[model samples]
Target: MEKQKELVFITVIGQDRKGVVASISGYLYRKDVNIVDINQRIMTDGYFVMSMAVDAKAATVSMTEMSRELDQVGRELGMQVQIQHENVFRMMHRI
Candidate 1:
């Protein structure tokens, strides 16, 4: 049987700027995290918002470690980044 994927949702929000996607994706690539899907857009107010579905089962670091490192990356980019397990994200969004 195939191994189950450990999916997580990563959300980034902040002022629009260059290199945001490159920076985030580069970090993930270096960490061995696979991005399954991604969506990003600029809001009317000019804020940048991005959401990514990533498979972290093969990642070299734990989710907590990834979160901490991403937090630092966010700070450097002047943005806010958050990562949540897919199930937890779904649960929190459920009515």
Candidate 2:
């Protein structure tokens, strides 16, 4: 049987900072997650908004576990982070 692919989407919003991406990317890296796509932009309010899709099946990590870790990262970075399964994300984002 072929291995299943597990994907998740992560969003981070906060005041623009130098190490925001580094911090989040580093955390994901340590968890062995493979970043599939990443996009970040600054809003008129000056808050940085980042969206990323990661593949966890390659890293053998669970969505719940990764989400917990991301929550910790958000707390440490003083940002709001949301992690969601890719399917749910797509459904919610689809018009």
* TM-score of each prediction: 0.88, 0.85
**CA-lDDT, candidates in order:** 0.93, 0.86
lDDT of 2 by residue, 43-64 (tens): 9988899999888876646777
Best by lDDT: 1
lDDT of 1: 0.93
Superposed Cα deviation of residue 94, candidate 1 (Å): 5.3
Tens-digit lDDT track of model 1 for 1-95: 76699899999999988888899999999999999999999989888899999999889989999999999999999999999888986788886
Clashing pairs in 1: none
> How far is 81's C-alpha from truth in model 1 (Å)?
0.3
